[model samples]
Target: MYGLMSILVHSIMYTKFITPLGIDASLNRFFEARAIDHVQVLAHEIDGRQERRQGLKEAAEYIKAQLERLKERAGSNFRIEIEENAVGGSFNMMFLGHGISFGYRNHTNILVRIVNSYF
Candidate 1:
């Protein structure tokens, strides 16, 4: 199973030129160990479905819980939007000169968006 690192909700803002604020910015100094714990949880608890294509919703729920926790710790004026939906798609690829085609069916997709009111 692959592990996950604890992520800051503001880190999402970095994608759009936003920086962490107050307690959120200071978290990396104190939450280094907590990040490792997150890794362990993702590697174990969430592995129940992550290794397969069937349990993404469970992982998404876990992520939502984490985000909620971070939201509480964030300074101010930051809003988080977490979106989940059932999505399906297909793709084709070449592997070792062999034709490979795959499809996503009944798959759950989760998207997170961070909105900074100050901006």
Candidate 2:
């Protein structure tokens, strides 16, 4: 039984885990639906027991660095937010427009998270 969840950063919107499938169509949809130009998976948790978990701090730092990279790429005029959804096992990267454009229409965002389980 594999569970997966989704998150939207600034608004803190989380989606229910669409379970029982190893193939995540939503993730594919998410990547394809947007003009993601640049995306880098910073933090990743391997499929293992919590007690055996390692690299958590490294993963976190990598994610933070990636967010900063994205911010730089988007320029100083763009506002970015990274929200971790540990409960949902996901993370949301949001971009708020501060110059040249405004609101949802102009700003772009991405949600990155993990899916893991064993039955």
Name the candidate that leads on lDDT. 1
Off by over 4 Å in 1: 1-30, 48-54
TM-score of 2: 0.27
Best by TM-score: 1
Worst 10 residues of 2 by lDDT: 101-110
- Please give the CA lDDT of all the candidate structures: 0.68, 0.41
Supply candidate 1's per-residue lDDT for 70: 72
Give the per-residue lDDT of model 2 (tens digit) for 1-119.
12232324523555565444333344323343222322223322322223224444345555566656665555344455665443222334545743342222211223543222221
lDDT of 1 at 62: 77
Go through the candidates in order and give the clash count of each: 0, 0
Q: Candidate 1 — what's its lDDT?
A: 0.68
What does the lDDT read for residue 57 in candidate 1?
65
lDDT of 1 by residue, 32-81 (tens): 45676787777776655632444566776777788777777666788877
How far off is residue 48 in model 2, in Å? 6.4
Task: Pull out the clashing pairs in model 2.
Answer: none
